[model samples]
Target: MVKEYILLIIGAVLVNNFVLSRILGICPFLGVSKRLDTAMGMGAAVIFVMTLSGFVTSWCDKYILVRYNLEYLRTIFFILVIAGLVQVVEVLLKRFSSTLYSALGIYLPLITTNCAVLGSAIICATEEEFMGRIFKSTVFCFASAVGFALALVLFSSVRERLELSKIPRSFQGPAIALVTAGILAMAFTGFAGLGS
Candidate 1:
């Protein structure tokens, strides 16, 4: 059991990373990664939302949705749970970290629609290995969110460096960023078989 859990963590955090590997949260990966600080803030917020939503969505799926044969509504129900969690995160950030709050701006609220969060929740709730197991699913979600944070932080650091380096005009701005992201994604694929 311990080994299985460890492998699961390795799988989620690297082999199946929601950001780099699975490519679920490209919006924030690109939008909030301009600054390391803001990227960290967004990563922390996503970790909180994804982890909590995993717990809530798992319980709901087991005790409510699956029990009542309402599995078809999983997407809608999961979105509602994730949205509420994002709101809570937003409120807390606004009250305590005005700087990060302001920096995040639209991207912060956009967490409500971040497919990575919703994808993690859905995976936790529906994956056969995680079904009826809230703890395992929550752990998976946390690992996945950590993976997202890892990718965001690394990418932001690269982007910060890119801001200084000279490049051809045609390769500047989003063009270069996309190329960097692709290379980063390729690098992540080196971990493809690690968990196995």
Candidate 2:
């Protein structure tokens, strides 16, 4: 059981990273990744929202939706939950970290439609990969968020360096970021079999 969860974590975090591998949540992955602090903040928000939604959606699937044969409603339900969660995060951030809240700009609220949050919930709620392993599914979602944070932080660190370096006018911003993200994704693919 322990080894199973470990593999699950490894698969989610390193092999099938939500950002790098599945390529979900690219908005925050790119928008908030310009600075490490912002990256960390965005990561924390995603982690909280993803993990909580994963667990709740799993329960709803097992206890409510599937039981009642309402699986078709999963997408709408999941979005509602994630959007509500983002609102909570927004309120807390505004009350406590005004600077961080403003720094996130529209991207913070944009987490509502972020494919990653919805994808994580859907993966937990329906994916055959998780099946009946509810706890592991939730953990996997949480780890996916962590993996996103890890990649974002690392990318931001590198991009920070790139900013200091002189680059040609054409490849200065998003161009370089995309190229760097592609290379990082390739590096992570090398770990595909590690969980096995």
Candidate 3:
């Protein structure tokens, strides 16, 4: 059991990263990653919502949806669950960390519908390739969030430096950023077999 979850975590965080490899949640990935602090805030918010939604969605799928033969409703169900969970995270952040709340700006609330969060829940709950168990899904979700954070932070650091460096007039802003992202994606591809 432990080894299974360990491999799942490794796979989730490295082999199948939601952002770098799966190409999910590109909005926040580019929008908030300009600043390291904002990226961290967004990453933490995603971690909270993704992990909690993973657990909730898994339980719902197993005990409620499957029991009632309502598997078709899993998508809607997970969306509602993740949206509500994102609200909770927003509230907590507003209460405890006003600075981060302000830093996150619009991207914070955008997490409610982030495809990565929803995908994590849906994939973990329904994908036959995964364990389809609550614990494994939760672990995968957490690791995936961590992987997202890792990638975001790294990119943000490089982007920060890019801000200081001079570049040709043609490749400023998004063009350069996209080029950097391509390089990062290629680097992440090296981790392909670790999860296996």
Model 3: what TM-score? 0.89
* TM-scores for every candidate against the unseen true structure: 0.90, 0.88, 0.89
Supply candidate 1's per-residue lDDT for 77: 87
- Candidate 3: pairs in clash: none
Q: What C-alpha lDDT do the candidate models reach, one value each?
A: 0.88, 0.84, 0.84
- Cα lDDT of model 2 overall? 0.84
Tens digits of lDDT, candidate 3, 1-196: 7887788878888888888999988888888889998888788878877788888889888888989989899888888877887788778888999987776666667788789988888888778865348887888889999988888999899999999999999999999998999899999899988856
lDDT of 2 by residue, 39-128 (tens): 877887677678877887787788888889889998998788778877887898899989877766566676776899889888887778
Residue 195 of model 1 has an lDDT of 62
- Name the runs in model 1 displaced over 4 angstroms: 88-108
Which residue ranges in model 3 land beyond 4 Å of their true spot? Answer: 92-108, 129-132
What range of 10 consecutive residues in model 1 has the weakest lDDT sum?
101-110
**Superposition error at 160 for model 2 (Å):** 0.5
